[model samples]
Target: MISRILCTAFVLCACISTTILCINFKEQQWYYVISTVFSNVSNNDYIDIDLKTAHISRNVYGISGFIDVKRDIPDDAITIEIQMSRSVSGSNNYVVLPFKYKENILYCWLNNMYRDILMPSFGNCSNALQLGNREFKGPLVKKKFEFNKCLVNVDTLPKYLIPAIYKIEFKSNGLAKIYVQLIVRVYNKVF
Candidate 1:
């Protein structure tokens, strides 16, 4: 009985060790890096953006800048759309990803959907605007709104994403039209 118990214990230990090793190996297999960010403001009559501080640092990216709102933007006058695409290797072509979000009213979307669900997954929406004395929940009053080193939490991304270059586009319309694009690369880690 003593010998049988010792054998069972040894088997269990070996199985647990193997499982831990496999899990570590799997976790170390993939990583992502931000490459670039680009912004375009179509109509500067209502708003102006300065995204000079948005750049990649040590494989991570952060956005820090100010947006001057020239006029009071009504809650119903704003709309937002986000779309993502994956670039085909060795070509300039890009295939649209299945992820896309659209909201008709910016105030309602930011206060309800983004505040509760998306904010935690991406970054702190409140902190992003706090430097400018602004709050994430807003009708976007006329002011110089600033962002202080806001980084996207990429760890929440799905692990099944294959090695490729991905592009994300954020567009807002209403008082002013603004478009922003972010590019990132996902690749397998080298052992």
Candidate 2:
């Protein structure tokens, strides 16, 4: 009889405690900014791109892999679209050409993360004169340009994050920063 009474009381206490202590799991986020080591991008001195490790888990989550990228250097040489390969892909936020130029202020809640820019398959973008734009304009030289290698931390976390390859190359040295918005969701099951 006593054991039965104790069991009943324990169950009641557990139910009451759960009602009082429901958990609303808060989502995690990160974002960072990167600047070229060089003061001014020039022929002798060039802007460098680098990559760093990023993870989604509260603890012990990290990502690393081969990053492959492709940039559409149009025939006219006016606009270019940088796209990532299927294998070299990332989760959460990504870069759009319009947001490529801020490095002073760091936005809160979401912090942008960047790592050393490793030359994936083609370091070509970093080397080409147009990409490799000749600092000193020659007979064919037209304008100066810059590009970015970046990823964003989204509010919504990805279901699965795999190896990603992102490309960054703009028609102007004015292009410096990238923007990304993330949206993450958390579900809890109470039985």
Candidate 3:
């Protein structure tokens, strides 16, 4: 009798707890969608700037670009970094490794730059003076794993260093691509 009573009480508590959880889970979401703009600039930082053609191929993947300041440039003038979301293959969307750039993630923070859509920079660049991906460093970013679509951000960087050019080469495990919806934004400082 005692054993049966304890089991029944346990079951009741479990049911009640589950009910409370369901009630609380019926709350608001944590994320929100937003408007977009990926306009292009007339410079070299953009190697394949096209919304119409940016696509992941069936066998291969990746993306890279020239940071066009619209004129002659230099090194160490700017800094750049990128963060990509999880990449899901066409075969199985859920089974993914997601994208990661280990370099920029090093030297400072412990949090990975993969969750939300964001723009990252490496060196000093004015909020107004724009820098680009690899525009200040010009390093080739290799892939850590595979997936599909991912959002990317290119920040101008901290504005203490000189202005320079850069290139961002994004390689991957699948045949994914980069598309430009509109010029992300325009920079007032022309090269």
Candidate 4:
């Protein structure tokens, strides 16, 4: 009799607790910014993009890569995009273009996530840059640009996800800071 009573009490408590918790459940979406800095990069320095383990998140759903160079650098100064390939067919290929001149800020993000709102690929719109496929680009700030719908899988090749590393040939002596912001959504359960 006592065991039966105890079991009944336990079940009741569990049900009550679950009901209380579910009453406070809530959901939210937010993002955290992680920056990778290349301090005091000299003139014409080819700073290979290096990402420490902490700088990268396996759970990252989306990312935006850009560079912040000192104001002294000429607006006309070109920031080249070198895609170090990993696939067997295309190993390493890059294009030298003035993304900075075309737009003050440049960033890339995959399609099927938030393509309509992000910056478009560097070259032809028809041939959008692929992250896991080795295509990359340079310097930027916050601005309105068409984002490409990246069909490529960035996980296949780690280098593909990063926006820069090919080289930043500085016209003047100044430091450049490379940033890759990982966009993640979080939910707050209010049960």
User: Per-prediction count of colliding residue pairs?
Assistant: 0, 32, 31, 15
Best TM-score among the predictions, by candidate number = 1
Query: What tens-digit string does per-residue lDDT give for candidate 1 at 18-110?
Result: 998777655545676667667788888888887633545666566667678888887778798889899859256889988888645777667
TM-score of each: 0.69, 0.19, 0.22, 0.22
Give the residue spans of candidate 3 off by over 4 A.
1-35, 45-48, 52-78, 81-138, 141-191
Q: Give one digit per residue, the lDDT tens place, for model 2 in 1-191.
A: 99999999999999988875553223332232221111212222222232333453443222222212123222232222222222123443544424343432211101222211222212433322322221322122323333233233343443233333233332222222222222222223332
lDDT on C-alpha atoms for all candidate structures: 0.70, 0.30, 0.31, 0.31
Model 3 per-residue lDDT tens digits across residues 1-191:
99999999999999999997676545421221112334242333422232211334542222223222332323222222333332123121222123335433221211223222222321121121223332223222331222123234333223222221122223211122233332121123322
Cα RMSD (angstroms) for every candidate in the order listed: 5.2, 15.1, 17.8, 16.3
Candidate 4 lDDT, tens digit per residue, 1-191? Answer: 99999999999999999996565332222222222223233431423232121323453322222222323333234332222211122223444434222212223322222143222333332233334434334342223323222222322222212233232222221233333222222222222
Q: Lowest-scoring 10 consecutive residues by lDDT in candidate 2?
A: 107-116
- Candidate 1, TM-score vs. the true structure? 0.69
